[model samples]
Target: MTSNAENELLERYGWPIEEMDFGREDDPDVIGCAVLEEVEGGTSGIFVVRPGLDEENRTGFAEWAVQRVGRYFEHGPEPDGWQKRSDGGWQLWVRRVEMPPI
Candidate 1:
């Protein structure tokens, strides 16, 4: 589920921001959410974009985004970084963030 505000924010982007339920309905604290590519039983309904960069420079935007987001999470394993594959692909190995005990 998603809140009205989240939907509104996502609506500004249009395509690729598919209807996803991140387990946050009316919770304001659920400010950060993403539709990642590596999840099991995934949906092709999701995607990514480097809106701040030009098409030519978006080569590693996904990796960059992962490292950037890792900086703010409450808890994550060490060595959070991005890697480039030999096949001209990029991957970001992120840690499972530890959420606060509610």
Candidate 2:
């Protein structure tokens, strides 16, 4: 299941639930959440510029996203940062982050 914070991240990016094949009426957290790709320890998701949105805005949203790995999260730009794949999807690096539990 996706936490509220995770769902908020997707909504901020204008994530296309339907186009991504995960309907809003369904459980969209597990499959579409900003989760760590177990094999590579990375994260991936699709972002759309909607009808009124511009490319710049979409790109900004992508960069703003953070990948959640259980209780940890990772985010950055280029070289060792998150970036949009050639296919227009965004993927985060496999840099595991650890923080003291609150």
Question: What local distance difference test score does each model get?
Answer: 0.35, 0.37
Clashes found in each candidate (C-alpha, N, C closer than 3 A): 0, 0
Q: Which residue segments of model 1 deviate by more than 4 Å?
A: 2-80, 99-102
Which prediction has the highest TM-score against the true structure? 2
Residue lDDT tens for model 1, 9-79: 34533323222334444552332223322225521123333223333223233333334434424343224
| Residue range 1-102, candidate 2, lDDT tens digits | 343443665675434322133333343222222322322454444432223333443333334343332223333334444455565443542212346999
Write down the TM-score of every candidate.
0.23, 0.26
The TM-score obtained by model 2 is 0.26
Q: What is the lDDT of residue 22 in candidate 1?
A: 45
Off by over 4 Å in 2: 16-76, 83-90, 93-102
The TM-score of candidate 1 is 0.23
